[model samples]
Target: MVLLVPIIGGVVALGLLVWCCVCRRKRSSDDEPTRPPDTSSLDTAAKSLGFLETLLTDDRVLIRRRFDIRDIQFERPLSKGAFGEVWLCTDRQNTMLAVKKLLQHKNDAYKEIKDFIAEIQLTASLDHPHIIRFLGVAWTSMDNLCMALEYLPTGDLLAFLRQNADMLTWVKDKLPMALGVAHALEYLHNRPTPIIHRDVKAKNVLLTEQLQTKLIDFGISRDRTQETMTAGVGTPYWSAPEVLEGNRYTEKSDIYSFGVLLSEIDSAATPYKDVRSPETGEPLRVWQIVSMIVGGSLRPTFSDACPQRIARVAKACLDGDPNVRPSANEVIEMLLGRAVSDQNW
Candidate 1:
């Protein structure tokens, strides 16, 4: 009887231990984050070699710029957007490159393909120190239609500023970055066709190891010659009032965005982040802020530490009337402490 009791107790304890382990595993499984669906096969199907060949053959410039994928090796991903992703890659000579790939599983539509081709062409044609350099385009199949560009090791301006907030200063860090972007904007605005960078925020600006700025991401840029330029298609915080109101996007709109960027440099935060309701003391909702901006009653705030000269330029850029905004050249001259001649707008 004594031996039987010990054996029975051991069995009951074993059962309890099993139940506890099973319960723990259940809890763990519930707590685990849900993994994104694996779309590798879909990505492969989208990069069909036949489709890539067809698209390349249609464009003469693309035909000449065809890159042999065999010479390139894939590295880790750097960033991602709605339609595609940018990857860090290396060439046969071990040169580092940023490769932007357009990955869509659906059948190739004419408009989408044309826009992508135009973006590649525009990027390749640009030649400026402040602009991101284009290397070439490559593809194994349609899913991998990729553009190779110069890789800046220091990353985008927004992240760099946030990460190095404590160490950065106005003259040494901020001024140069602002100047580089201004130069880039001036170049774009003075182009033969006068390009309008639809999006001109800090995230679109990249930095070098030396902290020099390089303006990038021309996915939505358009020549001033294009008809119907009223699409409200940029980030909300950096967008000009006219752009937010679905009015025509002019070079002046870019100037307004530049002004917002100046404030970003001063605060190291998103535009209008400090704005709050007087009654509730809570941050204003996005829609409320947008309404106030379009109504001309609100503008991005500058920190007290911001230099008076820079603050003045920022205010001029954020003027309610687009006609009152300073030109990119004027902004540059202002920053340089040179006299800016009055322009009859």
Candidate 2:
């Protein structure tokens, strides 16, 4: 009976061991499908540099679609900035587009990532003819973030002015181009949430093959409903006096830049090109120009070549006081009201 009890206890022990093994196997099997994603292949540098997760804003949430990296064929690099590289790319249908690949930095990737996302969000929300179109953004498995944008073949207005000086010298052509820019600003300023284009300059204005003008580069643009912006963050030569004084930027600041663009179109001369430093007779540096502007000493000299009416409008736009500067709509009205025959000096 003692030997029988011992054998029976051994059998029960073996059975319990078998049952525990079976239960463990079943549990593991169930968990196999629900296991966390395997990111084992990504090394430390690649995990930090390449990994990106998309977070859409309320504006882009419903409209913008995420694209796959496999669909983009990056052909050539068009431009490069501190945060990313803008490449000329083609899609599946062979359509040309500009794609910006945003890279992560070791120390400041978080804010850059946020800004890049914000740029895509704001750009995607806009659907105006004169505003550059935002196609889509992509987050690849390898952690690269890309934003596809509309390609303007003719390049920016700065280059266009350089190439087509003859076309711009005439008020007939110049007025229309100026009007197009005004209309674009009017659309932006009148939106439900007004967008202040903090960095408005000739380089930010792009021309289409059809000679259509479109405003691009909303990287520094801000919606007015947010906190007030008080940074000096624009092309120094095109900055308003108030901006140079470190005052908060308003829509009037854009008008100040437009005034410089007006002089650019009229004489094909860059703003403050003739302003020489008293100490060295060399052209004034950007800082000096800003000092002169803020000190209420320097103003863009409208060449005798510029018509009186156009010069008058430019002068109005360059008013030192922000309150005195004409709204974009008012500037458009004044330009449209003037006839080509009325462009007399």
Candidate 3:
């Protein structure tokens, strides 16, 4: 009776184990059909880089400009931004260049790749002295996707203006800088298919060793025909009222930014920096300033030191009516006339 009882217990234990194993197998089989496929092999860095290379090859304009990653020699980082960094690099020929490299982990990899390609396409198609020169693009992996450009040691226009405020004469320095920017805008606006530089601020204007201005950063600039009625682009202080209101972007919007830039040049300060609230006597907040600007109740203030002719042109640019704002060519003419008169004086 004792041996029989032990045998019965062992048989029950084996039966329970078998049942559990069968249930587990059934559950696993049911889940297997719903499980995501293994995409790890397909989504690798090599595949992404390969895809980018294929896209670039398809672009006739870009195919000729592709630089092998081995040819570029990294020197040091010049600047860092949200999604990428600019490095001061050199080519095989020892020619110095600025290379903007994409940081893939910061954003959706596909979107970043597409935007980088778009920038490359637009920059390579452009040929102008007042615009930043696109040297070429290079990449070994997705993380190393890079755009090479001509290096400007003098830094951006805003920093240059502030640094040389005491030494820079209006005719020799400020006027020429403004004119160069105006010329760049004129070139962009008059393109066979016009381009609206949605973001035009002092920081985007880079200075050469000779302090000549070159318009840089076309990531936001769009062909006017392709532009929708999108708003909320550009630096607030430099943006036009129409742009703030989500109205269609036009060349006049750039003129408004140029007007704000004039204020910047004159005071060597950001637009509306001196503005204070009538009630609190404190500097107005960005929202308040934006509201006032959109309402056409506020325009950027000029310094007392600002020349009257420049102020006049800036005021015309900042006019509440978009129709009333001067075209880029008209602005150029007005400035040129003033420049000639100053030279005569």
lDDT string for model 2 (189-271, tens) is: 88888888877777788888877788888877888765535544566668787776656678889888888788777766677
TM per candidate comes to 0.81, 0.79, 0.82
Q: After superposition, how far is residue 320 of candidate 3 from its true place, in Å?
A: 1.9
> lDDT for model 1, on a 0 to 1 scale?
0.76
Question: How displaced is residue 290 in candidate 2, in Å?
Answer: 1.2
Lowest lDDT sum, 10 consecutive residues, model 3, at 1-10
Candidate 3 lDDT, 1-345, residue by residue in tens: 000011222332332233344435533442243233445565664566576668787988776888898997899998887667889998889999999987657435655676677778888988889999998887766567789999999998888888889998788789999999999999999999988887788888899998889999887677777634255556766888776655668888999999888877776777777667566668756666666676666787676666777878888888878888888888888777743332211
Which structure among the candidates has the greatest lDDT?
A: 1
**Runs off by more than 4 Å, candidate 1:** 1-61, 107-109, 341-345
In TM-score terms, which candidate is top?
A: 3
Q: Residue 86 of model 1: what lDDT?
A: 93
Cα lDDT computed for each candidate against the true fold: 0.76, 0.70, 0.75
Candidate 3 lands at a TM-score of 0.82
